[model samples]
Target: MTFEMILVIIVITLMLAGLFFEMARPDLLVFFTLFFFIMTDIVSTDEALVGFSNEGMLTVGLLFIVAGAFERSGLVERLVSSMLAKANTRQGAMFRLLVPISGFSDFLNNTPIVVTLTPIVRKWASENNISPFKFLLPLSYAAILGGTITLMGTSTNLVIHGLLLDFGEKGFNFFELAWVGVPITFIGLVYLIVVGHRFLPDHKSLIEKVREKNTKDYLSEIQPWNRQRFFSERCD
Candidate 1:
C-alpha cells in the first residue's frame, strides 16, 4: 500500500479506538482528526475548513439556538403536559411520546429535538411510574426516523446538499426525501408499538433507584448534631 493509504488507515484506526474507549468528546476527536488530515496534505486547507463556512453547519447551529429558545419559553412543556394526560399505560405513553417527537424532528434538527424531549420524557415516565428504559431508546430511534422525513430534518442531509453544490450539482429540494421518510416512520412506529414494546426493559430508573436507597437508609435525626432547640424550636 502507498504511504498515504497506510497513514489514512492508521488515523481511522486511532479515531475508532478513541471513540470505543471514550477517550474524549467525539467533536473534539473529529476536530483533531481534521487538523491531522490538513497537516498531512491529504486535503487542501480550504477543503479541510469548508465545513466552518458551510451553510448547513450554520443552519444546524441556528436551529440549535432556536430549539433552546423554544425550550426556555416552556411552550414544549405545555404541549407535552397536555399530550401526556392520555398516557395512562406504558404502550400509550410510548405512543404519545414518540409520535410528536417524530413529527417535530421531521421538520427540525433531530439533535435539538432529542435534547428538548429527553428530560420531559424522563420526568413524565418518572411521574407515571413508567420505566425510563422503555422509552429512551425509542425516543432516540424516533428522532432518527423523523429526521429522515425531510431535508431539513437532519444536518447530514443538508451537508450532503452542500457538498453537491460544491460539485456544481443541484441540491435536493425540501421534502424530496419525504416520499420515503413517511412510510419508514409509519412502519417503524407500528413495529415499536407492536413488537418492540415486548422487549423494552422494566428496570427502575436511576432516580428511582436512588430514591429507594434513600428510603432504605432513612435517618430522621442525628443525635450529636441535633439543632432542634435552636433551629427547629421557635420562640412564640
Candidate 2:
C-alpha cells in the first residue's frame, strides 16, 4: 500500500479511538483531524474548505435556525399536549406521541423536536404513573423513522442530495423517500407500541427520587424584634 494510504488509516483509527473514549470534544477532534490532513498535504486547503461552502452543509445550518424558532414558538408542545390529553393507557399515549413526532420530523429537523419534547414527555409519564424510560427510546426511534420520510427530514439526507447535485446528477424529490420511509415507520411504531416498551427499564426519574426524599417537612418560629431599637444599636 502507498504511504499516504497507510498514514490516512492510522489517522482515522486514532480519530475514531478519540471519539470512542471521548478524549476531547467531538467538534475539536474532527477539526483537528481535518487540519492534520491539510497540513500533511493529504487534502488540499481548498478541498478541506469546500465542505463549508457545500449547499447541503449550508442548508443544515439554516434548518437549525428554523428548528430553534419552531421550538420557541411553543406550537409543538401545545399540539403534543392536546394529542396526549385523552390518552389514559400506555399504548394510547405511545401511539399519540409517536404519530405526531414522526409526522413533524418529516419537515423539521428531528434533533430539536426530540430535545424539546423529551422533558414534556417525561413530565407526562410521571403524571400518568408511568416510567419516562419507556417513552424516551420510542421517542428517539420515531424521530429517526420520520426523518426518513423526506429529503429535508435529516441532515444526512440533505447532505446526500447536495452531493448528488455536485456530481451533476438529479437530486431527490421532496417526497421521494416517503415510499420506503412510510412503511418502515408504520412497522416500527407498531412494534414499539405493542412489544418494545415492555422490555424497557422502569426506573424512577431523578426528580421523583428527590421528591420522595424531601417529603418530610419541619416548621420553625421566629420572634419579632423592635425595628427602632435595632437601628439605634446599629448606629451606636
Candidate 3:
C-alpha cells in the first residue's frame, strides 16, 4: 500500500481505538486526527481549517444559539404543559409529543429539541403513570423525521449544501426537501400511533424501580450560581 493509504489507516485505527477505549471526547479525537493529517502533509493547513469558516458550520452555530435562547424563554415549557397535560392515554400522549416536536424541528435544529424535551417528557411520563419507553424513542424519531421537513432543519442538510457549493453546484432551496419529508413524516406518525406502540415495552423508569426496591432517597445539594451575577444587581 502507499504511504498516504497507510497513514489514513493508522489515523482511522487510532480514532476507533480512542472511541472504544473512551480515551477522549469524540470532537477532540477528530481535532487530533486532523492535526496529524496536517502535520504529515496529507492535508494542507488551509484544508484542515476551511471547515471552521464554512457557511454551513457558521449556520449550525447560530442555530444552536437560537435554540438555546428559545429553550430558556419557557415557551416550550408552557406549550408542553398546556397541551400535554390533558392527554390521558399513552396513545394521546404520544401523539401530543410527536406533533409539536415534529413541527418545531422542521424550523429549528432537532438536537436541542430532543435535549429540551427529554427531561420534560420523562417528568410528564412519571407523573401520568405512562411508561417512558413509550415516548422517548418516538421523541428521537419525530425529531429526525421532522428535520427532513425543511432544508435548514438539520446540520446535515446544510453541510451537504456546503459540499455542493464546494463542487460548484447549486444547492437545495428552503422548502426543497419538504415534498418528500412531509409525506414520510405523516406516514411515520400514523405508524407510530397505530402499530408502533405494540412493539414498545411498558417499562417503568429507573428511578421508580430503584425507589420500589429501596424506600430511601439519595439527595445531593448543588448550587447552580457559583459566580457573581450582573442580573442580581440589576434587579436590585
TM-scores, in order shown?
A: 0.85, 0.84, 0.85
Residue runs of model 1 more than 4 Å from their true location after superposition: 215-236
RMSD of each: 6.7, 6.0, 8.1
Per-residue lDDT of 131-198 in model 2, one digit per residue for the tens? 89999999999999899999888888988998999999999999999999999989998999999999
Q: In terms of TM-score, how similar is model 2 to the real structure?
A: 0.84
How far does residue 128 in candidate 3 sit from its true spot (Å)?
2.4
**Which is better, 2 or 3, measured by lDDT?**
2
Clashing pairs counted in every model: 0, 0, 0
**Clash list (residue pairs), candidate 3:** none
Question: Which pairs of residues have clashing backbones in candidate 2?
Answer: none
Question: TM-score: which is higher, 1 or 2?
Answer: 1
* Model 1 deviation from native, Cα RMSD in Å: 6.7
User: Candidate 3: RMSD over Cα atoms?
Assistant: 8.1
Candidate 3: tens digits of C-alpha lDDT, residues 126-176: 877678898888888898889998977888998898889888999989889
Candidate 1 lDDT over residue span 68-134, tens digit each: 9989999998898788787777678678878988999878999998898789888877877778788
Query: How many clashing pairs in candidate 1?
Result: 0
